[model samples]
Target: MAETVQAATLRADVAIIGAGPAGLFAAFECGMLRLGTVLIDALDETGGQCAALYPEKPIYDIPAHPAIEAGALVAALEQQIAPFAVPRLLGRRIERLQGSRGAFSLGTDHGDSIHARAVIIAAGAGAFGPNRPPLPGLAAYEQTGSVQYYVRRKEAFHGKRLVIAGGGDSAIDWALELREIALHITLIHRRAKFRAAPERLAQLEAASGPGGPIELVVPYQLHALHGDGGTLASVEVATLEGDRRRIEADHLLAFFGLSTDLGPVSQWGLQSALHHIQVAPSTCETSLPGVFAIGDVATYPGKLKLILQGFSEGAMAAHAIHPIVHPHTALHFEYSTSKGAPGSRDAPGSLAGAGHAPRPAAA
Candidate 1:
């Protein structure tokens, strides 16, 4: 007899998809409006691409701070929303959505479901997957955990012989960053030139000087993998001149960038363009009455794909959603400075006393 899997269920006033900066900020905004909120993300952790693709990379365009590491920015956002105590459903993909407007049901691939009055699609570029190399038996080695596409934790590479492939920013960045921890690092690129920032390329070049922890093998492509039982012992590469060389390595890090797809979101009835959800500029609302789209996943006239722009969109969607979630009450919008921080005694409708019930009709 086969066992049946049971779907776990949850309830919230607002369900914000994609736990990126935009989604995190949206949760905070909704909390300020006294709305019960929950966040869902495909990745196991928050911060979306900033956390998954390039945690250590520096972002210079964020307002206020001249420069901030991607991981640090995510950490700060996490701290800012600590008071909200928002529930997060991580490592699960939302496969289907049912119901409309005042009530909606979300079904996840893991058999989990959420019931919410309003839904926010903040999913940046939908779902992203790593681009794998063409090397045979790569999957077998990946099964052993000896091959990595992204650096979730730098400590994992400590004292291990690593052979990194690619000439992109991720490849060069990790190569330079991992030098201090890894036993020895060899960077293999198909061309002598790299596509990374000029400063980073210079740093890699300087570090490759005599006695440095890194070695550069340029104008070469990975030819084969030498290993047994899914454990890699070394890798074989061939030069453009047809010369082959082998290097001993315990691990391989390949950075070929990502391939993004709309995934289950494409199946939804919302209007879309170039894989982005079409939204109204005034409300950020999608075709569905109570469903909103923001961030990179949202498309609008004069839409700027900037983080600040996404932040504005989140605020707009939150304000627009207030009436639907609380039809009987008239929301009074006030600046944060006047209302004070959420949860404060001075803050209007603090979480301690805020209620979601509709106000009774006047006698």
Candidate 2:
């Protein structure tokens, strides 16, 4: 069924879904290979999860070059992809994917069916929601706008009243993180226990003084929602100990978890492991010829799901495809655009410490 799906997009030699570190690096690789490439992402900006969810967090373990924050690193990687001048599709969703390498079609909500030979799915885990936590009134709120899955864009809720669901790292983290801009936060969780790093929790605790830091509603569940015209005006809460209250807010932020469905695109009959398109352990080439996977979405025996790892995967996938696209050409590992080729730490810029650390590295 994926042989000839259509909508509105662009033709390209390579198409990368999700503009995280993997997708951005893939664009860089495509530029180096002189292949026309197009990068697509659900969010308006690049850098994927790193750019969106935890821009404030610092990342380490990228190998070599000390540390950097997610925001700065995303900006730098984005610059690297600029030379490619790859056509970009942002603030849009890929409804479906069809066909195969060099002959693929994309179905986008923008009403474009793009044609390409090869595709790389780098959607990370942010495309979908997590499996656990059956919250009260969550389904209605999700459809009505009281519950949100992604937190990449903070400006949207600036100066607006909001309520957040979840007591884990993301919940508390985002709650504490966005408190500066958001009007109000009623953190509703099933229990009092939080799953964030102890240090982060300490910071959150330090901020709570008089009203108790944005009203942490412990042992509480959203009983129901009362809003006018689908707009969330107040959230009804019921505690396990029989306490009840109503929280007035403008919006809801839910930092449950992240996932991806791969949707009908996976049905295009590409080689896959457990439905995920399979690629060589080291390189991201899928069993179906030119197709590849990179970034947080791609998996290998010991693959680490981090921007550092994603950057390496993008570079490797590009290098691997260079030979195939230019069949008669010999690949020179030393001179190729690939810097961090799995075992090497020469990738000029290391996202190793891209997460927020005590010290920031000079880009």
Identify the candidate with maximal TM-score: 1
What C-alpha lDDT does candidate 1 achieve relative to the native structure?
A: 0.86
Please give, for residues 1-363, the per-residue lDDT of candidate 2 as tens digits.
Answer: 001222344667677788887787777766655555677777777777777666755566556647776777778777765544456777767777766555777777776556666777887753654543455555666676566765646777788888888878778777787788887777888888888889978877776556654778788876767776667888778887778988888787766666557665566566766645557877787767677888665666787766777777887787776665556768665554454432123443232311111111122
Lowest summed lDDT across 10 adjacent residues in model 1 is found at 354-363
Model 1, residue 194: distance off in Å is: 3.0
TM-score of each: 0.82, 0.70
**How accurate locally, in lDDT, is each candidate?**
0.86, 0.67
What would the per-residue lDDT of candidate 1 be over residues 215-331, giving only the tens digit for each residue?
A: 999889889999999899998999988999999999999988889987888898899887789999999999989999999999989999988898899999999999998888899
The best candidate in terms of lDDT = 1
